[model samples]
Target: MTGDTMRGAARAVLVGPWSARTWQACAHLLAGFPLGLLTCFTVVLLGGVTTGLLVTFAPALVTLAALLWCVRGYTALQRDRFATLLGVVIDPPAHCREEPGRVRRLLAEAAEPGTWRQFCYHLLAGPLGVVGFVVTTVLWTVSTMCALVSCYAWALPADSAFGRHLHTPSMVIELTVGGLLVFHLAPFVTVGLAAADTWLARTLLGPTDIDRLRSQLVSVTQSRNAVLAAADAERSRIERDLHDGTQQRLTALAINLGIARQTLPDLSGPAREVIEQAHEETKQVIAELRGFVRGLHPAVLSDRGLDAALSGVVARSPVRVRLSVDVSERPSPTVESVAYFVVSEALTNISKHAEVGAAEVTVARNGATLRLVIADAGRGGADEGGGTGLRGLTHRVASVGGSFRCDSPVGGGTTIEVELPCES
Candidate 1:
């Protein structure tokens, strides 16, 4: 007990400067209180009046201005302060805007969920700021008086706004003692305030970071599921194509060849040779079916990986292709397959519609991302709805949480880039 007591006393004596810092920081935090108060009050009152006036004129103009100032402009300031004082990353408000046109844009802005959220934040800021002001100011004043009392023999006088006098000796002693007592408890109160600030900032400003990330993950998962569905749908389509066209032709050819084979014994050598020729034609039709099915889904993509699968695509491409791959690590089967299909489809588009001489394809893995860049020196002007192939490719990429961009200008070449996360 004696040793512990001595250690604590030494620590307390050493805590003098640190205690000063703590009080100083608290004071600085309090000093900024008035600014927050003014900002909150001004924004709320102005926002309310603007919203009311919006009903008379264009409601979106004034409300949008208020939102921009309150959230987009001031959010950074508030978030930075929260991080410094409370050590938290608060989400900022989502600022949504529409293309310029008076009535259309105004209606669009007013209809958005984010605008309403900004208005709510504006309304709440005033009351929240007032409470924060009182707590911070009171705690800071008390801590300062207690620290001043450590050296000064007399207590300081309290000046009132209403011309009240409060400088008696007994009053000084009581207030000084009270200040010292409250100062000791200031840290706990400050910690509570910081936590409240973090919570409220996150709730009012925008969605939490974790929440945003989770929502993104959900979207990715949904899109990937869509891709899988689309793949199955595509396989069924290819199967139907074969069944309806090549399969029927081959069946008729088989019946003819069988009948010729049975009559070969009674026929002349020339007749036998003709049946043999027809059999050869039937074999060609079967070969074409195999090739077409392979084009739809190559087994090599599963066996040899994306590099070899893409090589096959290049060989079949009508346009000259320059392929470069620097994938050091193998991605998950699904991801690699999706990426290969994306590149293949893009190259196919270039061959069919780009009207270009040559195309370049580069696939690489930089960290956990799989990057595919395909650029063609062909006629540009590629748009999302330009064709069914590009449209399907967009949905496929989106399904895997990947982004697809095609920059094809008139009289210029087309360039397509896709980035997919390789998490597995």
Candidate 2:
């Protein structure tokens, strides 16, 4: 439709008949003749037999399934044919293979619109192929003969009807001009036919709009999961680096400072004051670093599992937490991590704004769900909108196909509940 494209196409049309693309189109049409005819036979013959056999219970179902699968396979070959001959690739529709039972899978596949679309395409191909093959072949044969009449005309008997029809120089000139015109026009015709076939192939063979959207959704979900997993892994790695490298070095510095203070007893008063201050600051810094690294990702969680990990968390909380973990089996690492963060964040919130000194935390696994409940009898009206840090916990829970709820009424205690997929 663009001016530049129109001009380019006009140019191609004027001098494009001898190009390889034109010949490829011709060959494609010729090859499709046989392929399309075979498909037509498959639809008419196999389909009719399957329909008649429908009254018979088991045999009919089996035959129908086989027919559908054969049609699918045959459609794949047609797709490859066009791809190979005309350099056009048409992808097949997406088919879910998740059904566990054989008969159920067959029923599901049969119910899919993709199967019927392909069958319809098979019905139309034979007629389309016949037209393309006949038209292209006729143009090629007749045009070539007319263009070369001057060379082959001498071989015709002068007295024969065919020779007499084109014996004149004017006729030869006219026929040759017509032949040249037809030769130039043949590419457009073949291209037009091939374009029709391309449209049909894509419409029937390619995934439907719903299927395409579903595939996109699946891809986005997978990408989100990957990003979440990568982030968790990176956090764990940083935690390890801080614990093994930076924390160890800081601890050594604190120990050295402590040793320096006690080992030399003959230092000046000003010097001793500076050393004591430095030693105190170093110890404080070391304590903060240990908490920071533990908060990043706990090593004990990975070693002793969720129950012991939650116990450690409770031991460190400023607000006393009555902890109960009923999970007989540990959930996945991602789910466990989410559960830990949820409880930790809730407890931190209670410590900061709850005006209460005690809370109850429960972690339990019921079937495929890992559930966590954190309850406090503090002054209420607590929610994510109040900047209680529950929003991040909600997102974290959802990232693993889990749920989070905050139930905090005015004058009623806050109860935070979370559920995570154990498999995830």
Candidate 3:
């Protein structure tokens, strides 16, 4: 092969994706093993503290917290290392979001059951890491020592520490066989331990269901805020549309009608009667526009309260909707409006989609949650993403730390359930 061709082939073998990953993984395992073992040991000694007496338990507790912090940092490092080197994913515990008081939060987090379990694994991993490190280190050292037999005339006839232990007839013969075997096998052992370390890290450190759900709650809370912001935006857009379009047109129409009324005395012709007819039509337009704006967001939803507003909604539904509410006390405006909207939209869907003859809405305060149930005898199959309206309502409910559930079975009926945290 040409020199260039040979060099290219060499580079390809050295820098291939999996090849580079394998090389780095083997190197990290060899290095991290010692560190992992030391971390484990420190964790164990620190865990035995029962009291803090400044020089005694105090230092132990502080050391314990510091060791756990180091382990947490190491866990992050390993995640990056493993993902890059092995194309595998590993994650650390999520205790970072608990508010300002770091020491208190850390202590609370450490007190959790899983923390102790992970601490045990961290301790165990350190010893395993150390053992693997020493084995690989000794293998390489012994093989190098054996390789130098050719330079030293000290055929030393099985007189070296390792040679005498092997009990071979001659040191040169033993060195030749042992060096070749150790040189090849040492790397494989290190690789095997590296694989083991990855497995241990994943199995021990991955989040449990409770941990996952807790994290999910954090996400849910953030999403709830976004939903609220979107709702506010939608409300603003609707208000602007009404004010600029329908409201402006209604105001202009009213002004034109008033002018026509004053000018009617001068004209007693067909034009006068036509102007009067147009003036009456303008009054109807103004009334309809006012009603439309009220329906979009009623001031009553805030003034007379959710119960009265909801009762008004039930009264207006085409289908007979029986309202049963025991919410004597009021909740937060967001909670009440969301609850009201959920019921209103759900009933609207039932009337339009459910094809039900009758519906029932029950709202009651149960402890910290305001429970709402809207059931109808309509064709079922109701889901959060049922349609644009239902989806919007779902977003509205979620904005206030509330959940929406719709159950509709085909040819059966539909039921919408929602629970919102109620705090006045």
Candidate 4:
């Protein structure tokens, strides 16, 4: 390649984007300095006066609130700037929920970590901004003046100190060298200052890793709750459809067979026998349909609450069951459903796998939590991974923010305990 083309390519590669970025960084820091100074002054004045008045007057809390609010606004601006200029993504801290009473709410807001972080940011901004502004401004000013030194060389008189000692060619060469040094170094210096500002912004203006994780956890929890609600609604719909549509049809078929059996003559012999057999079969089918419908979502559970619903489950258990349910208030349908299923599954497992003659089922509601415990006096080595039923129960309980624990040692009686939150 030619010399000029090679030099142009080098300049583009080394100085093009970096130089633009450096200028942008310098502008950002210089703009932030005045804003930071204003914030520092305002915060200090308000803080000092508020601290002095807090001993006697309750109204001084308002001043503190206003100061914190302003600090948050300033921090938000910094975060936005960082994202825009430096391409650093930062999330604002989660907002605190307001308490019932005004004073309590104010205290809660003031105690938030984000509020203090912002306060610290505002306090440090003035000094940090000053440093960045000075460094960047000096570098750019010196670099530009050196780069344009040839343009102003004529203004220096030959009798002056610089002109008298240095010949024209020597002066030009020295000026050119100095210009190249400053011009090349300016972008790096600007970038260094900008990096410092970015570090401060990220540390003070953005939420910490723990805060981000907590936010993600909350979002996941909300999504889980939504999914559980949808599932419950679908279950209810299916139960309704079975009860009103298929179950009703089966009941009507049974009734019709009963009527035909009654109407048929005894003298019909073989035909009479066939009608009787069909009648019996239809009745059995109807009974089976009722069981399936109840299994999907029991009508008693919805009508009479968890106590009566569990009673039905215990009654149906093949093994002897000692049932004790003490619940004064009816919990939400979702919680009740989870509790019922947990007990039902535990009992079924005990009947099939535990080889136990007797089991104990206890369900009680303590404040906002519904606790269900099922124990079987049988050889117990139950594992959740051993069966789909237990794993399914675990998922169901977790969906509603409930906990399911199984303690079944080898040769020891099995115990399944569940705690379900009743909050809607």
Candidate 5:
């Protein structure tokens, strides 16, 4: 073997004998014993009382509710202990929303499956704890006594039970060897027991699989909403900066150029022609900037609401658009913005891909939902997975708890529909 390989082996042997994890596992096992026994006694007592009171229906219901509540608290304490000692953290299930009355809320909590799972865990923990505690205590005690046998060997009389067979040299060798083996093996045994306890706690005390999935779904939904909200805020900020800062300065420059063009001498030559061209170019730039600002987020959308904003969209479409709005009250700005983009993109696609001259755009509010439908009398074969713009619009609608759908048959008309919740 190489010199490096020998040194590495020596280091491994030294490190293996002094791992902190071994002590932690031993401590965890020791703590579980008392906790498990206490939990077991409490669960049994409460369960028995609750069952016995079942003869009186109302009392039984009340007692059972209280017992379940205690079990939840106990499980939470155990979960914390497991995290502190073993570094295993399990997520608890979401609490049920409270109903109107106190009794209803209590009953709701009692009906949860997690509450019963906790009870089951407490029921089984007592025996497991006893077994772990006994095995760990016996192993450590025997190992320590054997390791120190040399110190006490001379004190015992020759006729005594242990002294009769004790040959100091041979006894020391045997006891020392046994002690070394047990000392090294104890950590593995304790760790195994700790792993078992952790498994039981996670299986019964932690959230169920369905609950975990539901939690993940809720988290995803919230994150999506946050992203959409941030994007919308950023768009609004950019639009404001352009309109209030850049657009204003551009408008002032165009006005100044026009004034300079008219005030310059009527030379009727190259110099006069240059001034007029500069003025016209400035005017053209101002118009393009206006269009860009509108595309970012139209001021009309904020000032006049979806009705007028969508009217602007229809007016700008290359093809003629039949438009209608039936909203009794204005929806939120976010809903209106998404609706406008949906229409704008749809019309853009229609003018580019659809071989028709005109399309219909409809917007309506029914109860708490805002509905938008854009239909075109053109040859249609729109596919969401075919890398069409409709797929992006679908995601946009879904980001705000909305649904998007498209129906288009080859050589037939295409229809795109979206429904957004506009609850105030």
Candidate 6:
């Protein structure tokens, strides 16, 4: 009511025992003992009953499953409590898979390591909870009582111990000092116990180190795949722009030039020669643009599929290319793009460096893997470190978690084999 008292109260609320965290710590300690006791009793009774009934296999299985699930439910409750009170979030392990049959589902739940971890949590919580509760309750109660005892001692019955012991001011002051020490110490004690509880809960209820690492790895893999998909999509867009926009314009320009050279035969000799030179350059530019667009990403690869696309690639190759594609199901677009590039680059290398007149290309799918084998019976001194595109192919294959192997002996024929995942 007084200004000083109000100011003291405000200070305490701001940074003392009256703060929310202190109260939460107190609440956590207060509840831990009962929860621990109940957990211990439940585990003991359930384990005992389940063990005794093990002779009956069916009954034992059901009981064991029930026990694991019961512990799991308790663990969930503890997780909720920690999150609500101290803002600590724990990630539970994701190890259980539901089965069609009830029995199988129960088996999966029981067999999971997380189930046993929850059970162990209950085991440890028992003793820790009881001790925490006892310490917290005794310190808070006794300290407050002693610190305020002087105000109440006179009201006690005359023959009572407090009334008979003189209850002097000196004794009152001494007890008040000692009690105040404990009163202040109580919050620290509660905080320490709460910290211990948090550690136990997080360790038992949350994911293991391996699980966290696996989660991070999965997240990174997903992000990397997303980037690859985006890049592939962008390449397709660029290819489309070239094929639809720039390539179309260039084609029209070349045609117009060709028409002018053919139709304008009455032009002067110098003008006719200029028209002829421009027509030839226009044709050459269109051809180069076509090659550039195809190198970026081919429309056939997206419109049809890898099979149709590879066939077109082999058909265009100057060196005799024997192409065999056996893809039953279409792979993902990103994967198809990578495959197209791999085949196209390999063929280009063969024509440029292999000094071969013939090359063999075979593509097949085995389960979820796409296999490609390109071989040439020419001089076979292919080096990935060499200026050939083998190094680039290796990196591209690895980007999609695929493997690229090149086997080329100096005198033997060159063989390039690649295996890519069919993410579809």
> How many steric overlaps are in each model, in order?
2, 0, 7, 0, 0, 0
Stretches of candidate 3 exceeding 4 Å from the true structure: 1-27, 51-89, 96-108, 111-113, 153-174, 206-221, 224-228, 266-269, 299-335, 343-364, 373-418, 421-424
Question: TM per model?
Answer: 0.45, 0.77, 0.65, 0.85, 0.72, 0.82
- Per-residue lDDT value at 167 in model 1: 62
- Over the stretch 72-169, how does candidate 5's per-residue lDDT look in tens digits? 77888888888888788978856676788878887787777877788899888788878888988988888777777788877755454655556457
Say what the RMSD of model 2 is: 4.7
lDDT of 6 by residue, 136-230 (tens): 88989999987787778777454546554535677668878887777876777788889988988878888889878988987888898999999
Pairs clashing in candidate 1?
Answer: 223-399, 224-399
Worst 10 residues of 3 by lDDT: 13-22
Candidate 1 C-alpha lDDT tens digits along 13-113: 44633574445445435634764666567677776677678666755476665555565556677676666654566665544455687656656666766
Identify the superior model by lDDT, candidate 2 or candidate 4: 2
Model 3 agreement with the true structure over 178-237: per-residue lDDT tens digits: 775666555556667778877777777667678789989878876766766567557746
In the range 277-376, model 4's lDDT, one tens digit per residue, is 8889888987887778777788889889888888898888898999999999888888888888888888888899998799999999999999999998
Once model 3 is optimally superposed onto the true structure by TM-score, how far is the C-alpha of residue 26 displaced, in angstroms?
Answer: 5.4
* TM-score, structure 4 vs. true: 0.85
Top candidate when judged by lDDT against the true structure: 2
Model 4 residue 53 CA deviation (Å) reads: 3.8
TM match of model 6 to true structure = 0.82
Worst 10 residues of 6 by lDDT: 157-166
Q: Which stretches of candidate 4 lie over 4 Å from their true place?
A: 1-14, 17-19, 57-60, 83-89, 157-169, 266-270, 315-322, 328-330, 350-359, 376-389, 409-412
The stretch of ten residues in a row with the least summed lDDT in candidate 4 is 158-167
Q: 1-424, model 2: which lDDT tens digit per residue?
A: 9999999988887768878888888899999899899898888777888889888879878778878877888889989998899899887788856688988888888878888889888988899889989999999889888888888776755555655556678877887989988888888899889888888888987888888898998898778778877888998999999889988998888889889899978999999898999999988988898888777779988887889888988999999899999999988777778888888888889999899999999999999998889999999888777787878888888998888888999889999888888987
Per-residue error at 229 for model 2, in Å? 3.1
